[model samples]
Target: MPGRLQHKSALITGAGSGIGLESALLFAAEGAHVLLVDVNLAAAERAARLVAERSPGVQAAAFKADVSKEAEVKAAVDQAVALFGRLDVMFNNAGIMHPADDNALNTEERIWDLTMAVNLKGVWWGCKYAILAMRANPTDAARGLHTGGSIINTASFVAIMGAATPQLAYTASKGAVLAMTRELAMVHAREGIRLNSICPGPLKTPLLMDFLNTEEKRERRLVHLPMGRFGEAIEIAKGALFLASDDSSYMTGTDFKVDGGLTSCYVTPQGEQVLPPPASLI
Candidate 1:
């Protein structure tokens, strides 16, 4: 039997050293022709090499493009279609959290501007181009169904829940992503295009760790984690896989929070189970 995404083509931005890279590898393993895109050519190349090592015949390639630029993003998607016949999955996963982005009062103007440019506007460009591509081929002749594709935007749990240690700009940009995703999902529902956002919690990615290099920084964020640990990049990649595959054909406009139970918790971890112990039936 073929893999879940057999014969499909996927373009994943931020496909360098974290969740995006892991997802590229996993998608290739499942038989999608993966296009590994990133701002760093070297990083994207490294990821492409890894995918090739696993599946030599796979049409995996790498492209360097800053997601913040409309032309670069459009060109990347066009390149993927040229190489792989169609763009089946467009994963707009590129993003940044500037070190200076704290609460609104403390965050600098530059930081706020940069965050919206890359996170919010970048995702908008991806969706715009992907929709244009998908619209051209709305019905899969083989399946005899609407053949539009999946557009997965990387939002954050912070978009849904307020953070006390506010990366105000980051949180705000992700919130816009969720809202845009829902609107796009509604507009394109009949066009067969499914749009959704992945609202991930604090993962142990370079984007998070580079700022929190000190143990104190780590603990300050980790204490609130209900799982009591930072999630691995691969763990989040699995969620992307489900969204990309046909298994989630009915899913759209949904914000899938892969936050290790953090969003549901009423209290932060105090290095122990602080909740009252289950009452004994005496």
Candidate 2:
């Protein structure tokens, strides 16, 4: 059977591991020719190889690029279009968490700058070139079979709500992402380009797991979660699939919260939990 992204070409940044890797594989499985971009060439190559090995006939390639750099981001977009004829989607997923020592009063200037460069400027750079590439096809005839494109930026739940413990730079950067998405969506809405942001909550990724290695920290995060468990990479990928596919054709300048109900309630009763409602509730 034909897949949701058949005949589309997608460029995903930060595809070295975690959600980026999972989403790249998922996009390829759904028939997208995926360009996996990462700072780690080896990891990107391995990811592409995994995609090719698992999904026969799916086009997959790896590129080493720092999304924070405009030249590198532009080149990646150019490479994707050159290889696949057009750029159908751009997933600006490259991001970093603040170091444990990062706090309001003690965060270093260098750390804050680095985090901003990768987390915020990176997405801006990705969107900048992705929009230029997507707009390359001025006419319907030149638009290729897919006709248009989509842009999805990775944001965090912290962008929406600030916690007592502050990763100052990370929180600030993500907040900017949410605002940028809306403006970009409006600017490109006429070009047949759509932009959206994915706000992921506490997820079970290597980065988070490593940070929460201590039982104390893990419980601290878990107690705030209504689901009482962290989300998987695949769950985030599914939300990404919606934004990347025609399924969300009319959606732009919107934020999807894939947080297991973390943002749904003001407060869950102290001892009670708010689970995904039963099947019948649907």
Computed on alpha carbons, the lDDT of every model, listed in order, comes to 0.88, 0.87
* lDDT tens readout by residue for model 2, 156-266: 888998653557888899999999999999988988899999999888888777766678877777766777778888788889999999899999999889998877756
Q: C-alpha displacement of 65 in model 2, angstroms?
A: 0.8
- Model 1, range 133-243, lDDT digits (tens) per residue? 877654566743346889999999989886646689999999999999999999999987999999888888889988677888888777778777777788789899999
Task: Provide the global lDDT of candidate 2 against the true structure.
Answer: 0.87
Evaluate candidate 1 by giving its C-alpha RMSD to the native, one decimal.
Answer: 5.3
What lDDT, from 0 to 1, does candidate 1 have?
0.88
Off by over 4 Å in 1: 138-140, 143-146, 273-282
Clash pairs for candidate 1: 138-147
For candidate 1, the per-residue lDDT at 121 reads 96
TM-score between candidate 1 and the true structure: 0.93
| Cα error of candidate 1 at position 128, Å | 0.4
